[model samples]
Target: MHLYAGKKHQKYILNDCPNDQLLFAMGIRNGLTVSIVTKQPIGGPIIIRIKNREIAIDKALACHITAKAVT
Candidate 1:
């Protein structure tokens, strides 16, 4: 996952994403210029925009939740 911050005018390219479902779930829209790329088998990169400040995330404490509507 890659994080970017700007005046909501910045664009991001997400390479090798798992699926389009994740991107939609993250509240991303086409106008936002958020690109999500997924591999054929699954698993890839996801990029999202955050505020123009510092954010801290702990990978060890993170978890994944599957939605019935996403598959």
Candidate 2:
């Protein structure tokens, strides 16, 4: 499922993406715990928290990401 579709404060398990290097540099990886922090208005970046770090990713890149919600 798309990471952008995730709601704020909900935890999710991150999945692999085509852009491994980029995501890795930002400390994101498969099986990592992540959560949506905030989404900018007017088509801007979406802020997400991975571990204790929060990173902002664009919508275009977010669409390519796959995340499974954690109950």
Runs off by more than 4 Å, candidate 1 = 1-19, 33-71
Tell me how candidate 2 scores on lDDT: 0.85
CA-only RMSD, every prediction:
12.3, 1.2
TM-score for each prediction?
A: 0.25, 0.89
Candidate 2: 10-residue stretch with minimal lDDT? 15-24
Q: Put down candidate 2 lDDT per residue, 1-71, tens digits, no spaces.
A: 98888899999887756565887787677788888999999989889987788899988888788989999
Candidate 2 residue spans exceeding 4 A from truth: none
Please give the CA lDDT of all the candidate structures.
0.29, 0.85
Task: Rate residue 31 of model 1 by lDDT.
Answer: 29
